[model samples]
Target: MDGETALDALQNLTSAAGTNYSIDKNSDLGDMYFNMTNYVGDTLKMMCMMRSHHMLTDVVLQAGSEQFHAHKLVLASASPYFKAMFTGGLKECDMSHVKLQGVCPTTLARILQFMYTGIIRVTEVTVCQLLPAATMFQVPDIINACCVFLERQLDPSNVIGIANFAEQHGCKELHEKANQFIEQHFTQICQEEEFFQLSAMQLVALVKKDALNVQDEQDVYQAVLQWVKYDEENRRPKMEHILQAVRCQYLTPAFLSKQMKSCDLLKKLPQCRKYLAQIFKDMTLHKKPCVKERTPNTPRVIYIAGGYLRYSLDILEAFNADDKTWTQLAKLTVPRSGLGGAFLKGMFYAVGGRNNAPGSSYDSDWVDRYHPVLDQWRPCSPMTTPRNRVGVAVMDGYLYAVGGSSGSDYHSSVERYEPDEDRWTLVRPMQYKRLGVGVAVVNRMLYAMGGYDGINRLNSAESYHPENDEWTPISPMHVARSGAGVATLNNCVYVVGGYDGSKQLNSVECYDTEKDTWEFRAPIRISRSALSLTVLDGKLYAMGGYDGTSFLSIVEVYDPTKDVWEEGEPLTSGRSGHASAVSFHQCVIHCDQHEHSLSTESSLGWCSTRPSSTLSALAGSALNGAVPEPRTSGVGAVSNSLSAPGRGLPDGSGPSLPYGP
Candidate 1:
């Protein structure tokens, strides 16, 4: 009949059937159907409108000069603080007007709006005030929103205050993120006034961390001195406690001499002078004094995989940058050079490469996974194509293999591996075949750059989008380079030293993905090719490679902000065609009785090349004849047996320390 009559009929049927119906449409159990798509939104909006008009408002929340009218049931359901006040045996349960202490009127108004509308605006002006009120009221969503906002706003100038605030408010994740920012920007943060405001213990705690991203230990010393100078009269008395954070052993002899001669503070403290004297004496005697704690160069262990020195080598060496020491790990399953290495989900994967022996054509399609906790290796699914000098990266939980050669011919094909499924599948190929390519991932896009085609060394580059399975060309380099070391930092992709057609080139280039442009950066001192590059603690470590005339053991570190390069300790020996990955594991100098051997075969039908005695020999060379220590070998054994430097073992089996974090 009419629209109103039809609507009345449906409502009558619905009222007879009840609010939630179970009618069978096919059986024609009911003649009417009803639904409200925006029922929740409408009901909440009506409640908000009623409160705004002060209609049937049951309670008044007073904060300073401001007051808000709200329903007790709505407020109680939205926040635990209000729920406890209304439902628990609190006096406010019966009170019509409740006054809130320690809350700003404006912030209280925002909280009331969020409680009614499920939305709130957090700005720089309001966040500081709103966070505490939200935390006090136990509104988790607003608390998280405030934390996320603060995390994004962190910078060198304000990070210290943000970190302190996060700690005070018990925001664990935000505090950790802010602390990480402090460590990453320590050099810049030292120049800020907020850093000078830190307490002595807080200053000591920041500087003592091995992960502090200072290019030179001298910076750390200067930072501590500056902190003390900020309030010399009061802080001078605490100098001894703060100075412990400076690794005196790492300061250069020249810097120490300069400071001792010019600084009046060093002249006043006998203990500081004595400590400096002892360090100088140790330096003169060529004795590296042991720091009680294991403070490595970076917090993570840098694992150098197979490489070619004279011939292809299977040696796996772990380098601790802080102590400038190397410890030999178990030998690789195969002798592989020109391989690609990466860490995915706490495991290190060594990808395709060739056994570069003279007169050999043994290119490999293997993928070996190392369990950091177990200190053992197991094979994953091999790639569909054999690759040497392959460029590899991980993005979106999948490992990607870029262009490489197969000994006889170069390839333009690319493949992706799924770790959980143990499957390898081919994706779109690149525009040109390349060997000695440098591949990196930035903003989830994989980039392949600088490799040798059959006829010439190529300066071209391309990027792959996994979502569309497509490859797009990008800007070419200034000159052709093959075997360049590539890494990404601060959304910029850097390509380091590689070989041109005539000679080894030390020129470096950085590409900004946002701008799609390239610029020259400070190059390594040594001209090299086939070097391994990885980022650790906000610095780029360019490991051993070949310098055309000879295999080189040089390790140069790049500070991007300063645009300068500094030489770190060299590798144990000259190497080329090596691979590097940062892992959270450290290895003991000696093997345990229950150590898992590399001889075991995986279900995918891959096993170690052979049980080599060369591993022991290499271990002897790396570690100076230290006696073996016994450890129970398993994942659980790691936490119990991994001792810090100078900490005695639980069973009193050995006194020597392991070489990892």
Candidate 2:
């Protein structure tokens, strides 16, 4: 007998056991147990070995019994009768202690097999029974296996039962899976009376928690309607609750309105009718509001103005920094009595426009430049072609003028304005002439959205690129409109109210540059066209415009974050075709009505009340400089430092508008 022979014998025994056991020869046990003993030592070893073997066998038998007892203890945790027999054994067990349990014995046997061999075989019938036992024993693997088997067998008809079982056991994953399955198959199961028995509050909870899909939502609505038939008085309160929940969750107004009409709930209850109306109004009025606030950190504001009426200027405003307020800074010097303006670099160049003269040509080649910094107006080189009611916007610092009407005739001529040389260059003309169209810049590209294309109001839109001077067609808008105000915010360009050939439009639509798609947004509070559009602090403000009958002073602010519109302070004057601009410091709004004079009130620039000495010290520390000695006269020293550069505006010319309002 040698070490090799002993090792071979152990391997043979392990193979014969039929258990998946393999001893590693590199293990510590292999090094210690491999050697064999001599003949005399072997005799002594045989006797010792026999005793040791007996002790080891006894220990293993005791361990097996203990394991059985432990298993019984775990089972007894779920039931008491099993505990008494396993813990007290036959010696102490009696009929009185053996209280019959309801759980299947076969299920218990399967659980015991899993505990002993770490293997489980689940059948459809026993899966339900074994799941609870596995959960009680804290056997995660067995519980998972049982759940998988149950899930695979579950269908729409068995969803309720599966949901109940999962809920009772507090199995979150299983519950979610069952809930999703039920939602996906709700149409098949919703015909049952049990679903209708659920309270309206419960139904609402299901919808709000996303436990129902579109089909399931329809089923719930149908079921709730059916419930109302049996007991109107009992179900009215529930219906109201469900309607309120749906409204709060921001469901489509059209769908909610349909539901209300289908159920006749609104007619039955006065309060329900009022609530429904309010929800519809609120949904239609939803808008994104301005979130950016003016602070000491804000820099400068840029203003742009343009117009289409005689002696009027239509303004297209924008901000240069992160601030949300529109500060009137830039202006159009030579106001095109009835023309459009576009911005390039820091200058707003007024495009082709017309002056009032009956029977005279409605076209002028005049252009103006208003310096934002100097707050003064000056003349700029005019356009090559004279036209009015044109679409203008800046792309990559080049001003582009789209289609317009020249001398009572519509022209599709396109021109580009260069600020450096103060000259206009002709570009490729548009395929169709579009007058009073909405123009917007998104990602350095100009979009010529819906407007009147001479013959009829057009729903068509097109994109222009300055790099190649090429025009490409885009998907048309939902409504054929003209005079719409277009502005871009958060990467989406919004086309606000305009006229749809026959009537003024209150419709609002958005175009996503990333998706290259169009969608209807919350319409404006009033139907209008020729309105001024600007984005300040991320919120879009739709200012003065004509609604069909009269000019509007209504100013509605759109909040993108909340997707709601709130009434803002109306402009001092109601005039369409105004100019708007936003900057980090303030918001500047301008209109072309001479009757509505411009306000000289300062827009309240960023003002801090902290002591001048403290501010100076802070500034010094930021620059890593030594603390300067304070002057004896506090008043004079404070005034001098506070009046330094970057402190505030130097001229204090109220806010600047690119053109005279």
Candidate 3:
């Protein structure tokens, strides 16, 4: 049962069996077994055969001459590790679990030397053989010993083998350690000529993992270019591979310029110039004027629709020109609704809404798609969960739906849908649950703005980056509100009217993404929640919604440049809960009239019939009587803040007045 007693008994058995003992002469077993060197070799070979038979046959031999004889047979043909293990005085190691049975005798002997003396002599051939044996034996110290011996031997010629070994062993840390060693010692291996010899897949993996330093990246770029320039037949397919690597690394402008110069060197190659141009086309950042003069007779109407309403559809529309005529595009199929919608490429998507009842309904799953070119609507894939008042936007051609309310419960789940694939994949949930949220996209990033989180309205904003599939907090809005319409105009997001927890608001706030700040602007003429705001012809327009008691027909325009709001012509009919879109020449409004019909006498009675004079009278009143003294209380309070170049009216006409009631 004791270690020393077990070894002494095994040695006695091997010595009595006429086995050479010199194999164990220099080991601890010899010192413990009374200097049995006379039988060391024979004892070692006998133990090796016994171990091999035990490993292959799963049989245990009695601790006597019979076991010693079986081990001798195994040692004659066993692997070096096994031979080393047997001769190194390992009298009783459990050999039944040995995995590598094909190792050679000489290799096994060296392993035995290491096992006995804790020193391994590694050469090119033995290094490979010992590494696997060390791992198989579960001897970490020996494995590290092998690694140290191999580290000094690594050069440009052997880096590929080291990398392969590291990968095979699933030792990422070791792989990195080996890679660093190779990078330091074998610079020529990463040179242009040498690097080009690597497979494209390997190059891509290296760049993607950011495994290369600046010097290595430059070397790789140069080598890839050289191959493409001089060895066209072999490197033609590698052009795309190189470009992908460059993009992943986000090479500096200087490096890109160098790449461009190298591209010129491949001028004679087929489609080389075209390929280079395609890689740079509209992908790199470009600087240009924000607004360009519109060509004469060009149509610039943009349409937006889809949200929730109570008992009817609530569509909001805004026009772009001086004509501030807000129209009801269409009503929803139901009413008492709060929902989310997005414009993806050319198709407009609307989804999710809740009713007045405490619970959400499957009716929220109604998904409508509108094509601008054909001016029509069709059904598309519905969301997995019937949520109300969700945040939706498109980034990188994928649509993301953020937190919303399912029934009365608030959810923080986020889902992404790919239209081309017609599939939705769940993503990491947001930190907060929100409903009636505002969503916008800027610089390819999606922003979820102010919304209600059930308990109170939210002013905090968060942005999601698809590259990492993560969200980061941004500047919060000045005031918390839900059902606020949001739109990106001139690279800044404008949060229009929405209902605060207490009341509907007309206050407009603009968020500067670059500055990460928010500033108040001209409030719309009417305070409304669940209204829609849109940009047309470079102007911000607030369209129809309920003021709280009844649906509104008034439309207002905010000149961001001037920081002033002016009333415009009203919708043709007095109906709220409608969707709006910028049409060819006007703001096309759609009214959801499932509950309230346009033919209803009461609806017709509330329609505004005032002429254009209504605008002039209101302007005159605002400019003279209602205009506040230069105190910090009214429009004049921030007069100095209105420093933008005044909006140039159509045909250079002055600001037009609204027709009188």
Candidate 4:
């Protein structure tokens, strides 16, 4: 009784004293909290001194014949395998030396270094070996670093190898990434050696996945035949199973007969033969064939819309840049010239223009929009003003039909079209009325520059800010221009040749929107009006205009960096007053007067000429010599693309043409 009472009394006294001290006293533990990272880092840095330090090392890691003196605790903490071995009372943990027979000494060193200092250097070449070792050692950080290194180097040739490696190692994330890469590049992977190296079961599993992103059945068939040929005797037995994975129904009869039918692999496969017969039957029955996948993201088809050649016209067509061929599309509702065109949301807005038939000229307010997917034109809301010779521009998701004219009257009234609303709203009028205006967007502001004001061709330039619906007069261009072509590139708005009241001017001017300044750049080689100026691949293209003599079908391209113009691909047929715009490729719409004509084909063709230039490639020919024709430039300077010897039709499926239609 006495002992228990004494212990309770002691405990109660201590508790009361502690409570009083906390309530009655003020204390400062520290003013600022400090990090111990530097101290800890320095201590770890000393531990990583592999060549000099051996004091606390408890074990030797022997990879190959080389040995690394390391601490058990450090290795154990970094790897589950090492942790289990060291802490689970394994017999190897008691040994002074641990031998890793399958590991490379260099990779083991790098892995240990990473475990100690959180740093490792891995490359695509070295990671191939290092990844396996890291996986074996159960070192996740080194494994992750090696995986990342391999992924960055993944390409058509090596992606399959990496994917196979990732799958073998049970790396779920890496396997998923490799699968995606394989899908995106399946066509190219067919050309890789590793693709042919995959086993029959692996190939079947791979190709049979509905997620295979092959452009055509041909690609899959090619891959299968190549794989089978690598060891025909063994793979031949499984040909029927593998051919089932090939979407032979997606292949055309011609492809099946010409490419696949001749192959022994396809001839022997009963499943493939049945699929081909069904495909031919579907073709004969006029059933909708597989919608061939288009080239990804790149618009291989250039849509050609209305323009005047011999009357106000309403013809529409699309030119295939890939195959260098043209196919006519649905016609527009109205025959119009001076087409106000802009591309938005995969549709071409054919805005206001002037109607031309037998003896009459009428201003047209009809807005027919072309939908590529539907291959048809539907009427959108007409502009507030009926204008011909108008300038069309897109800025901030709005279509702007700037200054043009209503019959003989010039217009300064600016109308903005919103696609979502299917309506046009009048914006601030320009400072000067203009017809045949060259309008472009720079820095999200609509710039209306060169145009005629009925009595005088205007050089006065103004900028329209959409945010405030305000028009501010900027510096006037160096020359008065009307019926000129305008384009924007590399942050500058360029105005090319136009009639300057008295003469057809060839002078080119550039306006820097950021600097709010205008400077006369290099003049184009030829003087022409009613031409088109466009930017493709960061370069300016000027084509097809009246040279105060006759209409031109010649095309020219300007190198802004070099301040010079060179000849581009000449249009198959000469045209003027035409409208052209850049898509994934450049397109030109014929717009000549009712009485004049190209005297030949009605279709517009495309070339694969890249518009960008290497300023260092100063060896370009000028083609500045004048031609015999009144409107033709000597060199046929500006147009979209001209990939000589490699020009294909728009379909991209046909054999390449010889630089001509």
CA lDDT of each prediction against the hidden true structure: 0.74, 0.55, 0.54, 0.66
Better of 2 and 4 by TM-score: 4
Q: Taking the tens digit of each residue's C-alpha lDDT, what string does model 4 give over 1-661? A: 3544544554565455443211222357545544443455545655665323575688999988899999998888889999998989899879879988778888888888888898888764466678788888898888888777666656666667667778778777888887877765577677766677777777887886665644355668788888888888787878777876666655545556665557676676667667667776665443444533223333344444565444555766554444554555556766666777777644678877755555344666767776554445677767776777789998645788988766556788988888779999988888888877888875456788878776676789998866567888999888888878898887689999888766677888989887778898888888888777877645777866667555566778888778988887655554444566655411233333222121111112111332123211111210121221221111111222323312221211111222221
Off by more than 4 A, model 3: 1-298, 302-310, 314-336, 355-363, 372-375, 574-661
Quality of model 2 by C-alpha lDDT: 0.55
Off by more than 4 A, model 1: 1-298, 358-361, 584-661
**In every candidate, how many clashes are there?**
3, 32, 77, 22
List CA RMSD, all candidates: 26.0, 26.1, 28.0, 24.2
Top-down TM-score ranking: 1, 4, 3, 2
TM-score of each: 0.47, 0.42, 0.44, 0.47
Which stretch of 10 consecutive residues in model 3 shows the poorest summed lDDT? 652-661
Worst 10 residues of 2 by lDDT: 647-656
lDDT of 1 by residue, 403-456 (tens): 886645688999998887999999999999988899998755789998888778
lDDT of 3: 0.54
User: Quick one: best lDDT, which candidate?
Assistant: 1
- Which ten residues in a row are the worst by lDDT in model 1? 648-657
